[model samples]
Target: MAVVTTAVRSGLLFPLFLLSIDASFQRKSGTKTQNIGSFWNGSTGRSERGTELSCCALINVQMRQVFPIHAQQTRPKKECRDRLVQYNDQLDAVLGELEHHPEILLRAVVADGQYAKDLFVETVTGHGFALISKLQRNANLNYVYDGPDQQRRGPKRKHDGKVTFADLSRFDVVNESAAERILTQVVWGVRWKRLLRVVVIQVLDHHGQVIKYAVLFSTDITMSASEVVALYRSRFEIEYVFRDGKQFLGLQDAQMRTQQALESHWNLTLLVMNLARLEALRANNGAQTLVFGVEDLKRRAYNALFAQVILVNLGLEARFEELIANPSGPLNFGLKAA
Candidate 1:
């Protein structure tokens, strides 16, 4: 919460937040690690034995910054088998935490296809926030009945017919280009048993043939199709948070065995990453777009620390300002050129 307040003061966060919910697996060795369970590792393209962390992150769409608000270790269903540790259950906890911060106006919750289930959708929408997520290409959907109600039937008509991508006569073409065609419609999800704003993107080949396609949906039927697509694309930014936390920070290098210690370590690693990025943004004068290099920041920090040690040992601390002013001084050594 302090970090979020700092971001708000720095003008880095917008009023309308786009929250992303996802999970990442960290491979750990040894039997002493608490809550360690097998999970699917996307980097390896297969399921591996590891611990999973489910995170809810806020994405600054304009600045392209991702800040993790909350994260918790998720145990495999086959092991702990408790509903409280399930994905949707963890999401409820995240939402509950956000409820205390009324200043954060969450516009929508974005996620991938794995979270497109009925419970997840209902959980997000129940909080009065829209949900933008991908749908399986072969999901069962039907066109809403627009004709007259059944005058002689016990129940009212609901579905006109099944929806087919090959025949999009019922959908409106909202966007079109040489590369793809975007169509949208308010259709009924057969599995979810609810109306959804569905968007379909048809990727075109060199000859304009649809070689591939993808389906996206939003719980808010009033949301624009383009906005839904853009929000869903921003969901990928959370993956970068995980990538940086593991590769640059010591997200997976924690030696802690206890659950409390491991959770603290993981959150600290992510918090440090966020702070470093925030410092970079400040140094750049809060530019709308700037290049961020965690490696370069680390190098500068190391150089400064080394210089401080040398200055203190040589009793030249009084001349620190003068020495640092030189372009080729020790304080600037090993620092990346701007």
Candidate 2:
């Protein structure tokens, strides 16, 4: 239901790569809780575990957006953050840093609860992808069924008030392996598109453990249920950005006192990360790129993937020169950097 950011590691700040940071509030927004930790000067080199404002990002091929944008939950953890959309002009300030033209090719986006309702979607769609986000996964959506075309010569159920497109109070949803009927509802998309709503349900197994999931999606993509899962699953990879950033990248150390400093620091961190990923993308594909299990990334190569970003970020032309200079050096760092 809610995702909390875990750490900020050492990497490039992604100016355009979106982050899906989550948190469990240690202090209430309005209930008055004083700052509890020593202003993290990083002398100890770690976040002082307490009330802190931070976030993370995820990337998926199935992501439905072109550029990266940030979306926040309806309620920001800190009231000061509640007006961030207005405060920072809805992240419009960061657009210049991205330097993306046409505003429609933005292949990545970042978001959390505090983000305005459709900020991420708008940004990504502007670029050219359809991004499905978990930040507002359950926000109520409204739409009308698109079974027939508009030109059909018949009484329209929508205009005539005789047809019910979606019923929020009731829905029918089924997961792969379950006998109990799940209670679902219509969650509409921002645009009142005909087929944008979906059916979602949370079911408990025999062990009394609750596994929340959705039945089907209404996006324009005409794929099977597995495809939908695969598409949405890309969101998990971005989630790992939060985990890896907190541990390997310096996301929270953001020692600058000014708000711009913090935002700039976070964005730069993601840029560094994207630089590393661009290298990997030039080399690997699919599972290799998304692989993040500790056992997997812990190998000297994978650790280097997150650790030796400085070397990896070196341009290909420079790398070739280095290879020519020292053939036996660590040019063997990544997986077949051909």
Candidate 3:
């Protein structure tokens, strides 16, 4: 299924893609798609020049399927008459729509570290939604007082001494999971300001040696640590969508110079991706498989088109079945149901 938001950026349909492709491919390989422009860097946290787009997606955890719901390109600063439009502003706008809309009911808003600012937390909380995001490895955190308030004081103490990641064992562990590696979660506050639920995962090698560590947190302090970890892990669904679009769906292939042309090309590319996935899923009884990727969809589409053309030109009505049959050669388009 596919849906677009009514509130587009600057009265234009949101551009789902914004990035530069090497024109060198056209010179060497005679590639057709090429669009060059100086766009901001949103995919990677850098101050370099590149096209950056803000995308909002809905992930159905039960089905493990993600659908891009809304997308908008980050316009240049000069284009805005007033102050600059920051990426966080675009996020807040997208999230605000998800909050008050009658059709959609998102439980929590999950984002990466880029949207982990205090202002972002406040904005999301104001809309009555929890924000789940990752914290830097050396994030400054402090312990909050859970006991009764002090009797004599101008203001009750809200925080205690600083917290050290190395001393996690001393703190109360709210949840723990035993798998290939051990995961421990605890309720902690960040920046000594906001109360949050944090999960600390310790990755270990086969020899039982500590190899790596990951820290995730949630603004919804009432949520369980396990739930926080689960939501944070599911945040990668949007990344997979981008990867599929760029790899197989002509996401990075478009020859345009104007902003309008680029916007149309980007939106169309993502729209095609959505349609292909929906068609493939429907064809397979709504089941998803790792083997049945976008490549399979393209192959099937090509064969279907070829079959139609042959039937039209040669007037071979009886040979239509044989032409549409699954190719048994090296390029097989048969459905490998999972």
List the candidate 3 regions with Cα displacement exceeding 4 Å.
1-49, 75-85, 148-155, 171-192, 287-292, 303-338
TM-scores, one per candidate: 0.86, 0.46, 0.71
Tens-digit lDDT string for candidate 3 (1-338): 22322212222122222111111011111223222224434455445544444566766544445666555555546554321235556556767655455444466878777667777677777777888888887888777667788899598887677767766754555544442333444445655366777777676666766567777787887777777777777777777666777778766565564546655766677677666655555554543342346767777777677767767798886766665454763224464454
Report the error of model 1 at residue 139, Å.
1.2
Tell me the lDDT of model 1 at 81: 74
lDDT-sorted candidate list, best first: 1, 3, 2
lDDT of model 2 at position 15: 21
Q: Candidate 2: deviation at residue 183, Å?
A: 11
When summed lDDT is taken over every stretch of 10 residues in candidate 2, the lowest stretch is 1-10
Per-residue lDDT of model 1, residues 1-338, tens digit only: 66766776767666467888888888798887878767889999998887887888887766657788777788767767753338788787788788888777788899898889878888998888888999987889999988976669488888899998888888999999999999999999889788899999999988999999999999899998998888888888898888878877878887887778877888888788778877877766663765565666777778877777888999987877776577666654665563
List the candidate numbers ranked by TM-score, top first: 1, 3, 2
Instruction: Show pairs that collide, candidate 1.
Output: none
